[model samples]
Target: MITPGQKIIQEWYKVKEWRQFPFQQEMEATYLAGYSGLLNAPTGSGKTFALFLPFLADFINKHPDYKTRKNNGLQMIWLTPLRALTNDIKKAMQEVCDDLQIPWKIATRTGDTSAAEKAALKKKLPEVLLTTPESLHLMLAQKEYPKIFQTLQVAVIDEWHELLGTKRGVQVELGLSRLKNLTPTLSKGEGANEQVVKDKVPRFYTTDALNWNANIDNAKQNRRQPTEAENVLWQFLRGKKIGYKFRRQHLVLRYIPDFICIEKKLIVEVDGGYHNDAEQQELDKYRENELIAQGYTIVRFTNNEVLTNPDNVLSKIKQILETKSNSLPEG
Candidate 1:
């Protein structure tokens, strides 16, 4: 079964006569689930639609009367590494909005944008704004700029790999930091005046009710139908047999690892044969990096390794738990 967002994407694909790829479907589902992760695919693999269509589907799902909606300021911001690419992205996105009858305003604010146009944009922000990192900084410098992005539902950094480990990449990070701080305003007497502090990096949350419930259902299903390797490993990890309680098919943030010991912040994953594929490897690496960034130590084993040598895997996990326990400060 697919989501309404997935169904909408399928209809758009039908218009283009293009078959939707599994990765694209997963990306849309993950986005709608309020999770953030990297999409590492080869060039010219419809990466743009894999990212952009979800934004549109999410909006439509949230606003049943989107055709009549007006003055929705800056629903999305697309930051590209090259100013030249901004125009192409804007045209593509604008065409889709027109086709869907979304009634969204798409505009570009780059180094080449005229001063008069910039002044006009300042007066009324578009629903979608595509700009470079430098222009984003310039926008940040403007007075009351947060108001322009207060309604923002999504932010995309295009060509992120190219911008990594460079001065421009640092600029993008700084610009995004400022943008993430601009959250929706609460009404008076509803914690409106309270200051809520956050970390520099964005945290994952199941922001939508439908998506949250779906994830809960998935986690429950996974627990019920445990893989052979997962069941083998769980034999030793369960019931505090390893001196620490482990949860099977546990949901952490937006990910469901095979097993997780909360006290040790350790996650164990048992991968099947499909994990050997190049594309799956890239996705696994990205997922691991995201988990590591959240301060979790991960240990992975192949299905064969877990099934054939459960004792070895158990010993390794025991050693990790002992080390982690010893390293903890006195409490």
Candidate 2:
């Protein structure tokens, strides 16, 4: 079904006196389907519009009153392989934003981008950031970078064919890995199921296989080799530092959570990059449903969150604990 967002895009095209291309429509459909893919066409075949307008559609659909809404954090990252292309790309994107009065702040962060501009981004990120692969790595390298990307809905890598198989391509891959870790839903294509099965299910399987002995073994292994994120959070929770004892890699029914406070019935999960995959997300949903059904409160944090901003993570957990405590029955 064509979404209200798609319909809005259709209206925009009519207003601009432009005809929609078949590929553009396909791209919109794919995007609305919650899948990612590489779009290929000639340099000037309205390729940018194909991807970008759909994003606008999605945004409009989500926030119908977007015009008056407060500035949201970065929602999109446009990674072009070449620094020279930033201006043209930004102009094209900005035109759409301007024409629609979308109030989106589109900025470039290439080698040529100024220090003042970079500093400004740290203070308040734009709605869309256009940058090179190298610049993207720089953003990823910054402390507490995960917060900037928490609201990121999409990362569009332009000219994938140009970057593929080169060293720059590898940089893009590495950078995307970090971004995907922060925003797991920003991913593409198959082979995820295999990775999910081999890497994820063994440690925290959530299916109806009530193999308590196997789960116990898995929990032990996980606790022994806690992920960096899990380990960092554990240090705070270990000695009842937050006024409640927490067990690491504790078994909860048919699943294993990173940390659990039995007294508060709270489960804190630290998700790795693998959890971002579509199949693993489904598994996570199932796992969370099961936990919630059993009177457990689940709070999840990405690996980047725990590693980069542990204090913020701690504060949030403490807040949850306080709220849960306040709701307790009278003695």
Candidate 3:
């Protein structure tokens, strides 16, 4: 059986649409910050590739060393909120994996996926599994689903706005929050402090966790130590902290992250001219307080700030990351 790592390595450069992305550097940077959010661009804009490519690459390289048995749990999963788009996204990722000459496996299980295929996926887990929110809920309902998600390192939910104000969105929020509690890397409870995530952030960071040199492994005695910033991270961040991640952001069909940062357990939103009306502003404040009361450190970014001087926008984000890291103790 060809591994996903092998398939992607061979096909990485061959995907026709791969050459069209120029801003992908930014997208990939955000992905590495451990922030799970949207790509926020229109369809046919190569947004999906912007989000999935680096992730597939990273998954292939990392798994060879860390790959566990199917019983170890899913390493990554994609929840689209839309059942119809599941097949399209899965095919796109599979193509990228194939072109990279790496052995990569991805499967789609929506309401549309036949019982046979779903059963097969359960037996032989794929490197990347794409499905919808409801489908994910179905997976969660299974007797063995908890074990399945034991190794989950990332969950990319597409079209977040679709679910931002709806009941389905609530379900996903609850589900991901439960998963967050289970993840080894995050603080499971609502008690996490913001100051920690801000202070410990490393500068000139990675755009995509997937793009690290595959030859280097973190387990190496010397490898664990942070290297000189310029030597390792120059390719990803273009001076300062313009890093990124291949993140997916879809809302409407079933998601909308109007109020949450899944990784940091913080909720941040950017308000702009589109929402300057008194009613909207009041509503915004209300939501911010609601998230705050829920123990989230809600940060608001003005629209002009995000568009006019994005450096300020990025800096604010850097501070948030640092604050989050610092809040954790030196254990």
* Prediction 1 TM-score vs. true: 0.56
Model 3 per-residue lDDT tens digits across residues 30-104: 554445545677778877777776565456555564333233346678776676787888787777655554465
Instruction: For model 1, give the 10-residue run with minimal summed lDDT.
Output: 184-193
Model 3, poorest ten-residue lDDT window?
A: 210-219
Error of 2 at 282 (Å): 40
Error of 3 at 329 (Å): 47
**Candidate number achieving the greatest lDDT relative to the actual structure:** 2
| Best-to-worst lDDT order | 2, 1, 3
User: Would you estimate the TM-scores of all the predictions?
Assistant: 0.56, 0.57, 0.49
| Candidate 2: residue 37 Cα off by (Å) | 0.8
**lDDT of model number 2:** 0.77
Candidate 1 residue runs with Cα over 4 Å from true position: 184-331
lDDT of each: 0.75, 0.77, 0.53
lDDT of 2 by residue, 40-155 (tens): 79878999899999889888888889677658899999988777888988999999988887998889987676779879988999999998776776676566787888788898
Off by over 4 Å in 2: 187-331
Off by over 4 Å in 3: 1-22, 60-73, 185-331
Error of 2 at 161 (Å): 1.3
